[model samples]
Target: MAATAVPVQSRGDLVLADPASPVATVPAAPQILVPATLSTTLDSRPLDLSPLAGPLAKIAQIEAWLGTELIEREEATRVALTALLSGQHAAFIGPPGTAKSLLILLLAQAFDLSKFITLCSPHSKLEDLMGPLRLSQLPHDIYERLTNAYMPASQLVFLDEVFNLSGSLAQTTHRLMNEREFDNGNRVERAPLISVFGASNQIPQTPDSAAFLDRFSFRLWLGYVSRTNFPRLMALYANRPSSAVLRVLAHNMPIFASQHGLLTLAPPPVTLGQDELFSLMWAAAHIPIPQSILSTLDKLYDDLAGKGIYVSDRRWRQSQDALRVNALLDGRGIVTNDDIAVYTNMFWTTREQRVTIAQVVERLGNPLAVAAVDKRDQAKTAYDAAIAAQADTDLDSGRKMNATVEALGKLKETAQSLEALLAQAQQQAMNPTKIQRALDAVQGWRKELSEYVL
Candidate 1:
């Protein structure tokens, strides 16, 4: 079969079309900086990444907005934005009302891209998702969407209740997610999709949907807010006006009114060139993976396999991209032990196994750092236990005093040891961010130890 020729607009420009209209051109640049390219070619060609100098800054702005807009979702927001920068799909698994769908929409607004969203179900048809195919206007034998206002043409797509999609729709979606292309009743066409954001209340239990689930490179498990943040969350949403308040409310208003509101209430001033993003992605794929992490992953695979949990070799390779992308987000040109935090999302097959996987990754990523954290946590637990024992009538006051003293001594020793380790790490750590984290932890431990009573 001959490769279908898509007319070139600009060398790296993303040409926007109405899908219903005969030709598509780039949209007019609005108030905020314009976004460049969404999808790269299937051949894995390096995308032009010249414009990426500003993306990290832009991403930081979006992350700040997400942190304030959604309570307790700072990490999830970063993961999702990283997926966008890497030009990969992300899925959010959580109960409804956790702002899963809202995050995707907010990103679309920030990028000023066309947004397409659908609530998927078992009964959904291909036409419902991709739009109905119609006879082509051109003489060639082909079929295409009658309208471009569907998932295939949109820059950002959100498929809520994605796991609920069943039958042929699920299979079609799997192809869409993997290849970013689908047969349009006549010929295969490239999807103009940039990033797909899927949300579900649970992971797929059935074999069919599970395959589709694996296409998402970044999968985040979200849950309810903590009790400590519940009241503050309520107050923020109820009494506080967010940065997104004006734009979100104007969504349903007239186009002129909405555009004006958007122009005035631009989310972030930074822009990411399509070429620059693609170049970064190419760079990330080649970023060095430490041999230690590779060995650790191999052992982790064996350990998990022994427990009847299995990960495909393909998933393992794709996970490398996640690590590289994480490194890029951390402002590193190279992958380091610190980036192994990516495994916290990759190594777990079950939600219950997440904590264990996190611990394993933390130990492998930075053994000394993890050890310090563990010692501090243990000291805290011992101190808390001693205080509770002191309140008990059965425990003698002298015994309680001795226990408290022992716990305090352990805390002091651990704090001092961690401080020494932190000082040593600062000289050798490649990533300054990781070193600073160790420094902060050591300082926190010292402060905690200073609060102890004789």
Candidate 2:
């Protein structure tokens, strides 16, 4: 079925209209103005600027933009964006000053969506997250919360330090995050939320918020840049002004112009409509899961359970949605080994578990990498055999020299081809650590090539 168009009711507003229902218009919500100065030099990496044809292309654009803007966070950004496309929430676990809040805010503005953002605290009131209640006409006894322009109406929401939400506020937000519906004074109102991006310095400790924490599909742990990249990070920050400095001199169009003009002007067109996105998500959800992956998941479930990090059955099922999105975006009809890497983030409880999950997933999820290792080993054996054959005194000198040259040439060619393969893989790597490991291996091989200079 063709997707229905859910037009914005007001400027930058996205209304949560049922896909089966006719177009519904709601009052416009207030927009949050983000300064154009917030944008930095997107990485110089080649970008696919081809015209976007659908929601998938829009997501690709966002992914490319994220790669350019952030350093060493490609995997986390991709997962978070996938969660958003899948109509699921994501959480970033990191200390302060890690660009978690900034990235989410930038994404909301990039899509021109209305947003409700706040720093969560135990003292946060319902009126702050939602809205205050008001009496109705001719019935002082009847009242309703004024949800206009609140979290209930916004398209994107960000809660910094989300673990601090407690008591009744936490209970309300828990329901809101889970169902996308909030309780007003007298009725339940559906929120127009595409995704809620949450950030916290620590994991939720209180029992009350743990269930709320489980709602996030992608949980990423970020930290300071590594020593190797720290110099590049400093150069980027010191040489140029951070993108967040708004410097627009638009004295004319006050209605349409602000520090945000730099961001709004001639931005990339949004190709995916809400209906199409939802439909794609529906399709992804139904994609077939192979028994092998199911078995791998079963083992993973038992492994994590042993470590006291239990993933609920529901989470295990919903996790398929992310893998499905990954396959769909990659233009594959079925999920493959590459998609299993998502479990690293989907099932982990702490940063240490992230390491364990990654190692396990690499072993079980990537057939190509495993094959490459085997092939490299086989090539090594063949090279050694050729060298041994050349060393045989029973052979003629002319033939021996020829054989030695031939063996050396073959080994060099093998190393060169493997180096080229590593280069290609590095281009698509979401995780920098894997790419670095490949690079190290290539360097070691290059050094060994010189030692074979017989």
Name the top TM-score candidate: 1
Query: Model 1 misses residue 44 by how many Å?
Result: 20
Best by lDDT: 1
Question: RMSD of model 1, in Å?
Answer: 10.0
- Scored against the true structure, residue 250 in model 1 reaches a CA lDDT of 64
C-alpha lDDT of residue 233 in model 2: 74
Give lDDT tens digits, candidate 2, residues 44-65. Answer: 1111111113555676776677
lDDT score of residue 216 within candidate 2: 83
- What TM-score does model 2 achieve against the real structure? 0.68
What lDDT score is found at residue 16 in candidate 1? 29
For model 2, the superposed segments whose C-alpha errors exceed 4 Å read 1-53, 135-139, 242-276, 306-308, 367-437, 444-454
Q: Which lDDT tens digits does candidate 1 get at residues 229-295?
A: 8998889768745646565656656586556654323354455545444444544554456667688
Q: Give each model's clash number.
A: 5, 7
Our model 2 lands, by Cα RMSD against the true structure, at 12.3
